[model samples]
Target: MAKLPEGILGPVSGTIGSIVGAKWRGVYYIRSKGKKRKKTRSKKQLASQAKFKFLQEFLKPFRPYFIVGFQNEALYCSEWNSAFSANYKAVTGQSPDFAIDYTLVKLSSGLQPGLRDPNVRYAARNKVEMTWTFQDEPMVTYDDQITMVIYCAEMNKAQGSIGGVSRADGKFVFKLNPRIAGKELDIFIYVSSLNRKLISPTHYLGKLIYASTTKP
Candidate 1:
């Protein structure tokens, strides 16, 4: 068979391990239940919890992305890295390319005015969107065209019910104009805060995004 894509391996292993472990744990608990043992949470439940805990721990390295008000929230991986590299180049007069990773989380909730009934379940659900941006020095090119590619490392969305919450997972790609001497170039990603009132003014979170450049 052809080789599987490298990205498929991690998710596949996680899924298979979770399924097999849950089944095995469940079987063990069922067998124990017949021995008149004290009632206890099933092995499956425990294993699931353990799995989640393990995943959470594994994901801890990315926690910086979730913290509110992190700088560079609007930048995606490429933009953030590129900007950083470009800034370094601008300041040092040497081009150095690097990469950064980031993640975004958004939550929204609200209450709506009731029309006919004074008290009713008529509150409009809130929505949220997160955006990232990268501002960098301009680039020079002999050709007239530039191309950018965006790849999403991972994305997850949880739909809300009464709150009308929804999540989106994907990467965005855009080609920027060559950097000009006086003009600044920027890349932006954003999540809309629909129906949700902000606790503070909507300033850039500045954390959940990163960027890198392909060229040295």
Candidate 2:
């Protein structure tokens, strides 16, 4: 019997060299120990040979399993991308004329399935706004501005409903008839989780605004 490493003790030899040099069956035979030649084979040597053979058989099926797992992961990623794009379109109403901006924030704690349970939560938000001044005359109406804002909010709500219990907020502002005093109009649309607290503003994924208007 060969001395095993610390924390490992068994009738079987610990080192591969010990197992290969073991002699019980014809598989392995001891060379020579001290002056005496130990030729008898131990029962432990036969068990070791059986263990090695079992390991060879067990690993044969692992390759295909790993391949299938990779394929499933790829499919999942594709579906997630499609869903995200669709949601963005639905919320914005107008298809993005420019490149979409995206920010991802990871939750500190993992989330649970229930409504209120706080776990790992991730959020993505988008904003799109534009303002133009006509040198000739302003043709856009207050009703048009209100309608656009309402449409945007409705779309955002629909997106939030589909994407779990999340929050969506949007605002549209227009300076209608700036020639007239106190004629400006503004609209806001905001949504949030009913159960969990809203993500902190300091969080990396907190809030972002992107629009055709001047950035501040």
Candidate 3:
């Protein structure tokens, strides 16, 4: 299945027989494929695998945000993978029970200026409000967009805004999904440029208990 771009004379790609062809940093090369090995997992290896699997599933819901949130840090890897690498240790706990620490989770990373004196509150049943001021920084712009991630662990669901509000607005009113009412919500916010070329470090806004009409 190897492809010869120059009609059997140029560089090749893909796999052919026992050899695999690929390009790295512009140079084409071929290497014999290594045979797959089966090995029993040690305690340490099992813990690491557990963390990897747990984090992957936890971050799946945030895939859309990672595309722009980790764009600057992606480098040779994908945006999602870059985010996973950066947050692997920060959000994942130790062995025996590698639980995810929601407060330590980061949704974005970059050089963009973040909100000044930001605050969030469960304004009412099914409504949340966020307020912030623009910082006096050279890179700060009125057109910079605000992004938010509101997660409800009770229902294992998340919802948010992406580049839907401007930094100049100073306040945003996010209407929660009706189903999430009464659940505790963890909130995170960050700023990004319209084109997503620049992003700010994610800020954790603590948790809010969405009020419900029904009695506990």
The whole-model lDDT of each prediction reads: 0.24, 0.25, 0.84
Q: How do the residues 7-68 of candidate 1 rate in per-residue lDDT, one tens digit apiece?
A: 64422221232232112312311112224457787977765555444334333432322222
Q: Can you give the TM-score per candidate against the true fold? A: 0.20, 0.14, 0.87
Candidate achieving the largest lDDT: 3
Backbone-clash count (model 3)? 0
**lDDT of each residue in 1-216, candidate 2, tens digit only:** 464333354333323542433434233333433345477657666554554443333223222222221222233343233323222322211212222222221111112211211111111113233222212223222121111111121122111111121221222333222222121212212112242222111012122222334333
Report the candidate with higher TM-score, 1 versus 3.
3
Ranking the candidates on TM-score from highest down gives 3, 1, 2
Clashing pairs in 2: 23-41, 24-41, 109-119, 109-120, 110-119, 110-120, 111-119, 111-120
Deviation in Å, model 2, residue 156 alpha carbon: 52
Point out the higher-scoring one by lDDT: 1 or 3. Answer: 3
lDDT of 3 at 146: 98
User: Candidate 1: where is the Cα deviation over 4 Å?
Assistant: 1-40, 69-214
Candidate 3 lDDT over residue span 1-216, tens digit each = 989998878888999999999986577888899988699879889888878887887788788877779888877667887889877866545765666676678889999989999998887777889999777678888899999999887676789999879999999999888988657988989899888888999998989975565333
